[model samples]
Target chain A: MQFERAVSVEHVQKNYGKFRAVDDLTFEVHGGEIFAMLGPNGSGKTTTIRMILDILKPDTGQIRVLGGPLTEATKMRIGYLPEERGLYRNVPVLDVMIYLGRLKGLSGDEARQRSLALLQQLELDEFSRKKVSELSKGMQQKVQFAVTVLHQPDLIIIDEPFSGLDPVNTLVIKRLLTDLRSRGCAIIMSTHQMQQVEEMADRLLMISNGQQKLYGSVQDIREQFALHAIIVEGQGDWGKLPGVVSVEPAANGNGHGADRALLRLDDQTAPGDVLAAIAASGDMHVRRFEEAVPGLNDIFIQVAEGAH
Target chain B: MKHLWIVARREYLTNLRRPSFLFAAFGVPLFMVGLMFLVTTLISNAEGDLDSLGNIGYVDRAGVIAAADAPFVPYADEAGAQQALQDGTIGAYFVLPADYVDSGEVTITSREGAPDSLKEAIDHLLLANLTPQAGDDALASRLEDPVTLTVRALDRGRDLEEDAAIGVIMLPVVFAVVFFISAQTTSSYLMSSVVEEKTNRMIEILITSVTPLELLFGKIVGLGVLGLTQLSIWLIAGALLLQSGQGVPALSGIELPLDLIVISLVYFLLAYLLFAAVMAGIGAVSNSEQESRQLAGVFTFVSVFPFFFFTTFLLNPNSPISVALTLFPLTAPLTSIIRLSLGALPVWQFVASLLLLGLTAALVIWMSARVFRWSLLLYGKRPTPRELWRVIRGTPMTAVGTAAQE
Candidate 1:
């Protein structure tokens, strides 16, 4: 089944006096996809999310959620987990979750059942009746996450969802996001963590200083910043080969009984030609050969630094 | 509307279950009853002690008294009365002057201080002996009661009944106190709740589900209901206690004016909205609960300040100061109620004051909504006066990035 656009922001400009928080930003998140919004602190990621949620209106732009303007009904189908985490500290975890779910348009029984099931799935069922203040930070974060998803919203927006979670819980959330996406939910996440973005994001928009620096599919972005070279393993002293501009030892410490070397090709050299040459070199043994693609972290740093 | 109800229900239920609400709702009346009991017991013991005193001896030199009352025993001479007092045969002795009726002079000698009951008994006995005989039925009826003065109001052209007069004088103050207590409690709760939500960032989640106006109105209605609950408990307890014949003596016989009660409720709601909006605005701009409370203190002082001039207001609700207070939005709730209770407020004045209060309340609520929406995510520092003014004037807050520049 083809899913419609979950969110579309067009020519959105938000300013606080003389400073621009989001400048002519345009993006779209389709259903069944995890779209990551990557930005540094104070980079207007939250402001953009708030605008999408209708908590703040854009100074000059239009935002469509679920293929229409954000009405209360549309808001009911959207879930948001804010960066600044909060719940009623004195209220029981299940009760808070149920309250939030009800606010999102769930019936009392439905909210309760969903909250309980979510708690059980998240391994928080034992603490369901405990006050939120009594829970650990991670537990509280899980409860907040449960509240965000309890109503089975079609679009879920989470900011810094993994800030306080440990590795196990992070994996838990990652799996949940994947599961949600598979079930046709559009998830937009804002975070500074590039590794998580790389692992989960189908497409991403990276902003710096409230302006878009990079946006595209994760694979496409990585390919755009690719080193135009091949990485070869297995004892290669390949600097002497024709069409080789430079060769550097790869820093990756994969102990696969071979030394890795990065081979940068000249402008006229094709990757097939380099492979043919490496094959012709009888003294050299090649175990692995592949194009060198940049990781999201490196791309993020390069793009951010280049923008600055 | 549904979101508003959900938020309001949550607030009402959560607050109702709090220990503080329970303690305040039940503990205050119990405390009042205990205090009344203590005072009544002390007064009764004192009167009991006074009544147990022995009889007093009296000496009449010019025969002002034909015979002494039961609590008094007449002596033949002053020397005999003094001997009886010295011998402890009487608690004390009273000596009447030779021209007692003309001079109205008497002397009492006692080991202890004068007892009021004994003195009153002796004075009554002497007065009975000094009365002149009536010659006819009409003169005797006139002698029984010398004079009577009836009071009438010139403006209303009617005699004020005793209970109505008392109600007129006291109801305003009662209403004012009740309004102050109820509005103060609810408004303070509104402020603290806003501050708490903002500080905890729960508002961010809430606003996503409902508009800021909904949240504000929901909270106000919820806490208003809580305040009404508390007031109902107090009124019912007071009524029951009064019916049981153990209520406060000063309030026992006073009748509640229905008109005043209705007007007071209206004033309470308006005043609550006005003050609660002001407090919620302060809460939105404040970065901390302490800061919000400090700002709320100014408004609370303004609301209660009229009570200091309670007597002046009651005496002349038409006085310039009283009129000004009644007309001013901040002081009108209490002052107008007081004036209306005193039967001095004209219809035009009442209408004008209500209009002013209602408009001001609407304006405050609008400003509070603007401020709350703009400042819900702000932290670390309170908004500057200029920023607050801009918000109140409907200037959109610069987005987060630009806020740092300001």
Candidate 2:
């Protein structure tokens, strides 16, 4: 059972005075999936992640990682990236990274070697001797991220990992995260970047105001917020289609030219029937005939707003 | 413990590598040697010259007093003395007014900002002159030829090296101050380190593979080694200084008791551990360096109070105030060690104080460890002294982390 779930946060709660930062959040991160906790700022995502790391105690409920109680032994199996990124500012980047890696039981030489290898791979080898304070924020963030993974724990939790990154750096981190996931590590990340969630998250948990608003696969969430959108481009009017709920003009250029209207379906009509109805309008050519799947972003907005 | 070693090793290396500790360790001794050289040069110049004493004047109405014995030149009248004093022609004046014969009065008149040493010397000379005139001729004759008895201790053990031991013990006390300061200053570095980790939210990642207690213990133990390392070097330098320097007269008849050295080591370790544990607790509860400083006020007060009352202890080590302070757990380690070094201690009091101090240290460790366990995870705020007790009684320990001991 422990092997089945890499991290299980069961009805965990944390309160600071009267404010419940994490209120009865119950979720399980599977052993090999990249699960994401999606939320806006101050929504308790980091609080929940910290509880799993055992840096904080829940006022109530239990948390188990790698199938057992949180102990020194269990801690070896997890890596974490905190929301506020920092390292020892006065120390050299390599020294700080290796020192932090040493805290996780790596030998000094081994940590040093690994730190060099990681820095080189991240194209940060030249700056290893530079003080952390001298590095750019984006570069420092990368170094901190490397420190987090230096010991190579089986489960990695990253809070706002792509925050404050340029698009290129963000892409680099996205690929690195993908690579880690492919290695069969159970990676759970909390981020505000919805695009990263669409690209990487296999499953997700969305919470707001310390309550779970959505929890499931991307496909399931999108289906839950399903909307019918069709692209039509013929002389026949889009309004003439039977059971059509609404028709809105969409982008007409960029290869799919001229007449394009996105058609929304009413409740009782199948997308096939709408396709058949569009077929019945012989004067019009239906360039695209498919149900518009709501993305994680759309689902995020719909479900998050619904919760409020 | 291994984790603690790793942390300690890092702390020691980091501090040792820093230019500040290096300056304190090697540079300070060089600075001290330079200062001593300057002192010796001043002494040599003062001994070689008479004019350096500056023009000094005195008026003595007592006709029996001779000019040769006086510290200043004797003037015939107050007018010449007053003029020299005010014009800065003479450094200062010692006046023996006529009324002084009946009342034994002496007054020093100096220009504003006259050298303080000259004024002090005049007062001492005037007092010595009045002593002989305190009685009639018969009593006065006895004062000149009074019987003097030579004093000696019952056991003249280690008499030759007694003066050196004064410097030796002073080394430890000075080392203790430096130790108390450095240990405390660096230990707050640990507290600040922890507070920074907490505030930056980096602690969330750290505790995943190491317990907060382990981290706390590691920091204290690491910084403690750095302190001890610095102390050992300072001790060696102090011993060297005593061996080479001119003798100190006050320390000529003193000897350190053998038990003092043995008791010092034992008490220093116990006291350090107790204080370290308490500091870790404070560090755990504090969320900022500013908050940590405020929390550390108690430790600072305890460490400094010993230095303030040191003279009183030196005067009478067995006085009620000394005995009471030496038995108090917070002060006993430093005070008791000083007392033991000064002379042979009464065995019963020493043993009783040790027992009381040892128990208090143990109790302090347990209490501090409890506070550390409960409060390390409570971030974004600093706990009050009262809140810490409530945390110790029955606070939750569950949510801190799933630490995997690698």
Candidate 3:
């Protein structure tokens, strides 16, 4: 199982001037899993990613990729999508992808074939011959994503992988990432979007101000921060409920044939009591009722606010 | 190594397609060839000249000519020669005063312009009349082509022709300028390349793919080969010029100065490596292309500083100042080539200069690679010189940099 490690970073620290950008960062991303790095702006996520890719050297500690120090061969097996995005603007989309693929040790013919296949897969086939500058920002981002995965790397480290995409395109990329993960590709993604991670990531590391705030499975993290509340679907004025302290409106409501409400319970109010009262009132039909397991967004906000 | 070649080949091919590089590589040489063709045609035509001096009229007041050669229509007086000229019986006429022996002056008047052959014909006539060996063809021809001086430098064992001497002296200077100009242009491309990658933020992607040293060396060789390609085109143009000069009398006796060209090319390779390496560092440190060029000018000015002292170097190739410049890597390329041209270079000095140049080139490249690594991801602000120095001294960074050996 140790051989399954794609990235191993141990107590890595980086500093610019007196400010420590990444502090004692330690984690491992193994094959066949999606590991998400969660951080706010300036929380050292980019710094940590750069150090892992061997772009910026850490002040101390060790980082091993693909079970050892990065070699040219190791670099070839790892694809990175950097936070500061760019491609050769004047080069055609397919040509840029081929050049990048060749840099990773792919043959020209292999790179060409792979690039064409990826362009078609991403629905960007028509833009293959167009200059990258001609593509819209979202389209270019998708192309960048294609370039990242074209080489079929064992490990893919993408910063903000789904930023700047509409829901459809975002879903398209998410499906692709999920597929790669399913095929035993270790994916390390750095993002500020907690819901995205909650939906996709198997395990996660949350950092704030260069320190690790949390590290665990997505379910474990959500359960760890599970609120004393119940989500009531097809609901009434939950604010007036007996045990309820607050009611917050949530999504997938009206248009989905039901209205959703999160019922916050005060101390000493059991969730069983709330359900009993909902049953007693014939005024509202209770379709779904469950103790609320906090979404990653709630956990992220709580952790971030707690750190501050 | 494979990565470096991939980078270099890509760099070469990419820039090879640019119109600017194409124009620089081939256009300049073609233009020079065209200019040379024009000048050579004019010179050969001027020298390979008119059929005859035509009929002549003479008023020999000094009575030195015992008789007249063919078409020599001699008149007894200036009035008679002027009458014959007006009547168009003689193409031109000369009046030699009675004291021609003292003054050696001849007055000539004609409707038709006097060509150079006419003057030569007149001089030959006067020589045949006045000189005792006038009838001897060998002696007369000897007088016609008087002096072709060749000086042998006893110490150097090389001969200098009087006419080709200036060319030999200026050859090093011309070579130095041509080489540096190409170096400047190609290395500037290197600078822009580095800065562009950084500014465009593509370097982060690249740095992840290749080591900083590989990146630096790849770019240097890539653009260095581009300059070499340009130099090669110029060399072929030069060879063509020399070949075309085979039949042009004006170009005959001028040799290619092979020794100087070979040594200059050697120096150019070393110097270009050093210059391009430094420029790559400047590019990495600078946040913008404009800023990089501003920094580049300092090193370029130093590298070309030797050109300004060419006369001093040529006149005293063995002088202490010349020796210092030759030993200094930045100036060594031009100054040593000058000293070699002057035939004043000791084998030891030549060897030492090359050793120093090669060492300096290695040192600068190593230093630039360090700077490249440190500054590649740094943006919006430049590192202070002290910060740069500390990076060069090498911070105790952990694994995954050039810190780990290949």
Candidate 4:
């Protein structure tokens, strides 16, 4: 059985005077799924997120988080890490975290306990007493992320979570997200990091120019971009297959006796048919034949470029 | 309520931790105290020369006026007095002509004209020595039946000595100085903090954690409490200095009513809130320090204008201008406290003034809350008063959500 919908947006539209920020947006974040909203800059990803948070009301359509109108109580169940990270600069890391936790209705002692635990998990326990400005940019961002999830909200929303982190910190946060997902938190992240989306996102929503261009499971989106390509380790004359559209030598090039070829299929042909046909060429030694699914980056570029 | 306290505690802690806040709280007061000490010492040590000092000689025609009882120096005759004065033996010579008691006129002979002080002393002496039989009705009334209005305050908690009066007079000035400093410094703190956060895009994290109202209230409460702490230290220092009698008179005899203290505290609280709210409103709309200062200028004026009315309030605390000033929330905290510290205020008037001030404070706070909610989201551009009013009327609901998260 499917888990309940943690967040649902039904044809929501937001307009700032004459400028439409989000237009006819509709999506759902299912429980325990890592749903990523993928978009280029100014594609209304933040705007849609704001609408979901009830920070900005939709001009049209409806939004429900956990099956009801958004209130302060509902907000307590949702953890948000905005694209622009901030804390009171003069306030210490621990104090700001506990203070944020308190807003979600955690008592001081409870907030302190949870915040310290989070800081430890983020490997920032040593600098908890330092002011936000005293910390390095990446360190402050980690502290901000810690504050966001200290209350362990059922739905976690992070915008541009890896915008400024070094590779190590990015891996740390990606691991944290994975851990959170395992514990049954519904994570909705918005980012231009297609690599992250490809690796972490289970479902994806692609928006272009304030309008929804694509929304589905990551596999489904890749399937929708049916420009099929396959990598084959066969030796000779693979480009001679009847339905093969194009052939490119793999990065190892043809110099190595053990080489691979990327075969593209025509619109009407299937990668399986091409693989079968290539296998019939006994002149080629076949070691591997695997169809390459479209990556999130490829899907994003294709959909966004398709829209414009 | 718990959330409010959490917010308030956060505000207080953050504010207390700020280097600028710490500096203003301790540095400004200590500087003022040092400056005042230096001023008092300078004035007390001011020197005078022979030219600046006054001297006089008396010629007593009436044998009744013995030489021992002479007001100034005694000379045998008018020529001798004139010769002595011209020869620099005296500053001025007084001629007590015949029937000087009845005439109440005394001639003075000198090379140079007597100064105002000597003239005043000569008149005083002539008046003091005059007989009662020769007294006019005004003189007899002034001497025989002086109207003595003894002050008896209803609530006698602390004595109001002359030094207390001095402190009382100084109270308005002190609070005015503090209000001035606080309004300038605190509002800038509020403004700069807001602007810096907005510019740096740090407000986004804050918005997720706290409501705009909570943030505004927290900041005001924190800064106001801090301001009061500084003020209390200054007041205690002042009280101690007066009591020590290093040169200033000690507080003695006059009592401070419980009602006055209560009213003063309440007024200060309300006034601080009013100012704080206005500053928050300014901070919300401000994208820069220069813009914040310009926006908060009106509040600064309201906070400091009471000092200009200090003279009038002292002369007649119950006068129409004083009454109006004391009833105004911005001025009431300082002016009303000054009035209460001095004698002769009716309880009802004090209560009425406080009530008015409280009501005004409430009104300003409510209005400021509306403005703050609307403006806090707007960044890179300041909202106009008209736009703020529109937000209050709910015309621009969309704008409310666009607040600067920082």
Compare the candidates by TM-score and give the number of the best one.
Answer: 1
Which docking class does model 2 fall in? acceptable
User: Can you write out model 4's per-residue Cα lDDT over B252-285, one digit (the tens) per residue?
Assistant: 4323345654555566677676677677667777
User: How well is each residue in A40-91 modelled by candidate 3, as lDDT tens digits?
Assistant: 7888887788777776668899999988988778899889998887888877
**lDDT tens readout by residue for model 1, B1-406:** 8988888888888888878778777887787677667776765665554456577888888876764446788898889988887888887888988887688888998867676766766655665565563124355444545664344433433233453444446656765776678788778888888988977878878878888788888898888888788778877665554455334444456555577777888888888889888998988888788988887888888877778777876566567888788889999898887666555676777888899999999998898888877787777677778878887787755543243222
- lDDT of all the models against the reference? 0.80, 0.70, 0.81, 0.71
For candidate 1, lDDT tens digit of each residue in A57-166? 79898999998889988898888998876988888988898888888999999999999999998999999999999999999999889888898889999999999899
Of 2 and 3, the candidate ranking higher by lDDT: 3
lDDT of 3 at A287: 79
| TM-score for candidate 4, residues paired by index | 0.78
- TM-score list, all predictions: 0.87, 0.78, 0.86, 0.78
DockQ (CA atoms), all models: 0.47, 0.31, 0.40, 0.29
Off by over 4 Å in 4: A1-3, A233-235, A245-262, A266-269, A285-288, B19-168, B175-202, B250-257, B316-324, B339-356, B401-406
Error of 3 at B392 (Å): 2.8
What does the lDDT read for residue A273 in candidate 3? 95
Off by over 4 Å in 1: A240-243, A252-258, A267-290, B54-63, B75-119, B122-172, B245-249, B380-406
